[model samples]
Target: MRHSQADTILQDSMAKRRIKEVTDAVTHESPVKKHLENLLENKVELEQVLAQNSNIDQLVKAAGRVQPNPVETITTIDGIHPVVKKKSGIKKSQIVYDNDYIDVDYDTKNQPFRHVEQDDCKIPNFANTWNAIVDMRQSKKAPVDTMGAHCCADETQDRPTYEYQTLVACMLSSQTKDSVTAAAMDTLKQRGLTIENIAKMPEEELDSLINKVGFHKTKAKHIKQATDIVIEKYGGRVPNTVEELVKLPGVGPKMANLVTQLAFKRINGIAVDLHVHRVANRLGWVKTKSPEETRIKLEELIPKKLWAEVNHLLVGFGQTMCVAAGPGCSTCAANKWCPVGRAAVGK
Candidate 1:
């Protein structure tokens, strides 16, 4: 309390110097600062680890939006993959998934980048196999060849009636054998299946007429309803395009494609049914699970000019040689090109 001015000044100067020393230590060499710098360095290391593996990088980026930089060193580990033994001579370390004996180029250092060699099992040689099938079709005559949508009309019938009959036949052929479908068409012809008579006939009576065919009851209703639409909306002419043909009740893509081809002589698409589906896969022309998938795939492979003939050839081949239960692989000319056939015959 009784200090002199010079003593107070010296004490103040000492206090200022001590505060500066504490500030400098906190800013440059504190434990908290070191911890933060260590954390930033670890984060860069983590980013580098993620950037090295694309799979991990994707997972990290998805979780944290981390834009990892290009890294030379991988400081992380990938998931353990089972050791798969194969005869294709691919480096076991490079393959993480099933390669199906396909020779894939391996990068010894990179876990992400890979190149797959083209394999015959991946896709078909369609043109060569297609030619083989057509050649086989020359000697064979199937139920479809005589009883298909194309053969529904006699020479005496007018154009509109012929087109309508062809549409009706295509519609009836779904899920029904060609023989059964032919019988149904014959009965309809015997019953004078004019559009006027069919339009007015009771569904029950019509079903009784086509009772032998599959799903005759619903088909009876569809026939009457579709005929009404044809008469009312299309002036009794069948819709010429696949777009318009598919509008009718019970009319699907298969029926629509066939109707357009046979009725209007315009091949819009491949009409894949059970036969085409089976034969296409059995011959390795396509690898599909459904007729629709086969239809789409076939269109991509087959040129537009050959679209009309493909269904016919494939159908006949299916009915004659490639029957669902027991395909005649030994006798089949395409067996050499067919994977399933070649395997079946042990060639």
Candidate 2:
């Protein structure tokens, strides 16, 4: 009887399974020894079987206990086997906030993007760089505090009206630049912006005082609304926590965080603004789309101990060496490691 292709294919499959069964049964024996024994018993048959099925994938899969394929190791530029860790969403990349210090899990040998400078370029440590800049800038002159008007409330000669004035200043500073906000505060100081003054002050008169700032008219209304809430609800005391601070009119995370930072010396989160958002991303410390996202990213990477200092350091840097446009990157202290600064210098 002539055997068809199907019958021949079935015999070939049976032979492979029998080989797997035999190989699996002798688990205690060394693989090489068992193979040799099988070879000696049916040397001709085994040779034909080996030639027909050169690939061991089927046998390996059919075996009850299979030895897995080895994971190929990659060597880094330094010739070290880098410690690899898998973060859920992000691709393998390095975040060198400071040149002197680096925290990375994977080798940068195969990174998709190239740095402007060589890999071995000596970058200053993040902590040392910031501390030096802070000291240098602090010695030079302090940046105009956007909330200076609010803070002045605490320095009032009359302790009875201190909190009232400070809360008003905080509200006024929202959506206003420091210079404009400071000018607005000056007007308020000249004519008491106390809650009693604000609540009783005519809407037209209140808007006229802070008219120099952005959104003065709406702010005037919000000031009155916030003052009424403070007096009626919290007994005229500004709440220290973010939860309570946000309850005030037009006060979001930025205002809430700032108020507590200045008024109560409490910091629950980093207060991000246009400046903080720009400087953090330029420094290669955070990859965020918005100020709110930047605040969250900064909180994760920056140690809790440095939470109070971020707004100050970044804002100062933004105003000075890291200005929004025409920044003086050529003379920046972090120019060597700062991608933005280095590119500007190259330009």
Candidate 3:
């Protein structure tokens, strides 16, 4: 059918608008299409440069010049794309440049917008999570003192400011439940747990008092040796710094950092135990295999101001709701926003 000039112009305008809409959708929706557009633009720019240059050497140099935003060339087939760094062993789908063409070999399972383990993910809003868990567990008392052994040591007044007692409590609490450690401390209190008393107390007697805890016999021996060293070297004073605290028998980064924080009121670094390590990984805060590694990573990621609160908040959260075995996911306050909890509950 023959159309009038005005009608033909309107129809052409509509066709152009439709093409624009489709092009925009493809550019935004498909990674492959976007990559193609970039390649085409670069090709056109390269041709223009080559057409203007007469010298082959100059053209080669110009062609080799890097673009302002260089395209990430994927060279591995293990689902890792250079677009973003993934946590260890996480699978990803990405568009790769393959022999002058684009290919999409994504996992097809992971939603693009869904949160996963990526370096670009936001730092955890732990303050809000801490507040939520506090509200959740408010009715019930925290599984232990917020400060663990340090609490017991502080309560022992009228006994020559027993800083060594605080150190002993921290060392004793390792791998031992808070209640068990507290009970052992009570026994020590009754037996007059001072350097003078511990130095004189027979190893067998110390073992019997703390036997309820795990590895009590070995811990008892360590306590005796550590006590002797403290009395002999530091004149019966527990060292205030992490370097000196770690020198005590049975003390590690966890004990050293905790004692420095609670006993000495110095926050040298983050304290990572089994609970802290497990919870941090599950929350996608840090990917590490050991508590020591977790401590190091967390110190780098977490703000200095939040360092003191991480241990207490995570420990309490771990004990009350985010337990190692069969956590109370249904009643957990952070479950709604927690990625690990959501995945576990299949939401």
Candidate 4:
């Protein structure tokens, strides 16, 4: 018997045994341990043969070829015999027998479909988010405070660049509300809110300025120290890289990436704040359980071209539409494309 004939017998027998094993595992209501024991016993003889003939050195060299092992039946059913037809101009009805088989086909164009495992962080839906946001912005359907609205801030001196302001504000915004951070920045700007002024201000005075924000005492110390470092090390300018920003006393990946995106126009980094992280996972854009994990995953799945805008869109979307604990998916623009929406609608 040729290898081709043997493969058919092996595959058919294996398929039947697999079906029986699965059925028994599911239907057996007795102790799970007993059912598992029976299943293991059923495969014991086959396992021994496989263990004995485990040398698969030939497989490595047999590229673009399919090989089948010997048939090992777990149960004997009547009227069933393992046989396969040859492919050398033989009719399909012509039967042959063997313990093993092989199939060699050189036509790569018509090869059977192959499935490959993807990395957990590789998300294909990320571009959809970018396209959706661009559409919403073009149609004037996005919120008033979306990142697109600040494109002119870099050119105009009246409004500080959102990235620079965002970094300072985020530093002050820690453990504090957004409203409070805005108010604190407003008050600080009255005293000539430059790096020099911030570095020279006494800790007590800086604390007074940001006292309205949360953790004002600790934040005040960080702000003063960070400003001093910026003046001394970065020459009165905040470093734009994530590595440099994270080295500051109070900055983390979120704040650093935000600074990178907002200040320097580095769009390859993603800022995964609570809002971005929550909405990403909730939307099944990324299945991570933590913000840090979500950030790493987003960096992998999101195309570099769209990385800068992902956090901005998700943050804005999370704020106005997908509120935590009560996401308004019904009225969301991306609702049609969102997996979460489909799950919610039972589709």
Candidate 5:
């Protein structure tokens, strides 16, 4: 087999091995220590499989600096070096959100669309809009209120599996509407949404399940890769911190922030989806164009106590009344205070 394909197979085998080792270690007196020792002891089993391949040395040499060692012995399959850099002038792939860290080449063709920078985003009575939205939402229900990622799965299930489902729902929700995301999650839950099940499922089948959601193909690949990492690196548990969660494939700052908030209940940052971005701008709460800018600005302005509720509140408002099309400025609760609302109504 080609080196790239073989490398993938090697990583998959080792990840499964690690999962089995973890399950076996749970019965031992020292679970953590026993898991580590068992992993080391059983790593040679991977080599025995690789040794059976007569062309294993060629595969190892051609593998370059990738996961699962790629060294001659192939015993330490999980030991990996940094990936070799691609040749210069290759257009770097773009990522979601206003990410400044990753070097994904956000070239013109692949660049994510940015929000239109408003000329005047400051409104004097903006403080009243928060109360207005809170009052307005109490009487009506929006799609986000009913079908958000928080409602995607049965949380009463096992902790690890439920957490993994939470992460998957967040990933699928990106660039997709809440209703679509909830539906997709429902289908996956029927088929089993656990990490081990998702990791082993063929990417084609997983993609077909979530096909209604936007960018299903990309999300499916990312879900599979992330499940493997969660098992191999995190012992089948989802990473709780923003820093670690963002390291997963297809997870950007937005998804990472939401995962930390919803899955882990660790309120570190606001998840600024399109609804949050539009609502923040329409209320004149933030002048920024992009969601990332909105998130950073909102973080500074909103109190820590309200951080968790901001996204849900604004997303509902934007999704229901303060829509992207002709908004209901006249009848809306914030019409009296919101600058955009007043402008729309010619007040």
Candidate 6:
């Protein structure tokens, strides 16, 4: 047989052996049986076999002593590893197939059509700007930084009424990180800090409840005050307008915009947090010193339709790609478009 044919045969034999080993592992009454079962189900080629043979499921159930959740396993073909779905509700599986691969050949003469570099380097018209940014963001040269994965506000579980939740999260997020805010939210939920509960709780008791978070005393006070305003003034529901939201104690523009966006799905305002400000300046998109200034500049430059996603994207991008000091511009996909990054490269 030809060398290529022999290699293919060898690979096929190895795949078969791997499948058998996986099957045998699943059949054994071992602790790893559940994991092996998931692995087999997630593997594209193996899924076909498992679907044809009901014995595989029986073997897995018998060995593991537990019925696995019938999750839709997504697989790719470019040598990507299989991903098992977890019950944690967080989707981490992006690679869909083992054979699905994206190859960018540097030496190839027939390059794929991509975003064109602006020769004049002048800001295009507002309509053209939106399209240009979108095209660049989608291209390899200026690919969007998706560091936070699905943990961002946009990706979180859709609450029926997120106004109260958004307020609580924003308050907790002050002088705190997202992970910390999530924990504090969980703690508050466990302690029943709903609109009704918060309205009823005494100020001192509320303080004690949220004492784990920084500035808990002040936050508790603000929470009580806000809850009272919501109950007495707003009929026990969080306000929809940014002006009304910011009228509450401890509610600034950043918090107000966050609450407005996440709770009411309103894109009328921009959340100009520190991350958004820093990243915008670094990219030379908005020449502003403060987040408040950056917000106005961005509103003028970027379209209103993209206002909602800007904060989430820029915050995630800031955390992952553009560090405040000593950013990794060389590996950044937005380097081509970033003035600061281009300057760094020139240096």
The prediction achieving the highest lDDT against the true structure is: 5
Return the clash pairs for model 3, or none: 93-106
Query: What is the per-residue lDDT of model 2 for residues 52-118, given as tens digits with 9 covering 90 to 100?
Result: 4453454333333432111211110101112335322211132111112122221211222112222
Between prediction 4 and prediction 5, the one with superior lDDT is 5
lDDT per model vs. reference:
0.62, 0.57, 0.60, 0.53, 0.65, 0.54
Which candidate has the highest TM-score of all? 5
Residues 168-260, model 3: lDDT tens digits: 888788767898888888889888878889999999999999998766876899999998898899888777766566657677657877776
Off by over 4 Å in 3: 1-124, 154-160
Cα deviation of 271, candidate 3, in Å: 1.0
Q: Tell me the lDDT of model 1 at 199.
A: 86
Candidate 1 lDDT for residue 218: 64
RMSD (Cα, Å) of model 4: 25.2
Indicate the residue-level lDDT of 164 in model 1: 84
Worst 10 residues of 3 by lDDT: 72-81
TM-score of candidate 3 on Cα atoms, chains taken together: 0.62
> After aligning candidate 3 to the native by TM-score, how far in Å is the CA of 242 from where it should be?
0.6
Name model 5 segments beyond 4 Å from true.
1-127
Candidate 4 on 1-347: residue-level lDDT in tens? 33453344345656446534543444222222222323333343223223433322221122112221212110111011224444332321343222111122211112222222333225655445445644553444333242222221223333233444556776875544455666677776667666666767899998988888755776888888887787788776677655567668777656766565556556435667777887887777788755666776776676454554566556666666777656776766666667887666654
lDDT by residue for model 5 (18-58), tens:
54554443432222222233333344333433454344343
Q: How much is the lDDT of residue 185 in candidate 5?
A: 96
Q: Give the Cα-based TM-score of candidate 2 against the true structure.
A: 0.60
Per-model TM against the reference: 0.63, 0.60, 0.62, 0.56, 0.65, 0.55
In model 2, which residue pairs have backbone atoms overlapping below 3 Å?
none
Q: Which stretches of candidate 1 lie over 4 Å from their true place?
A: 1-125
RMSD of model 3 against the true structure: 25.9
Model 4 misplaced regions, further than 4 Å: 1-166
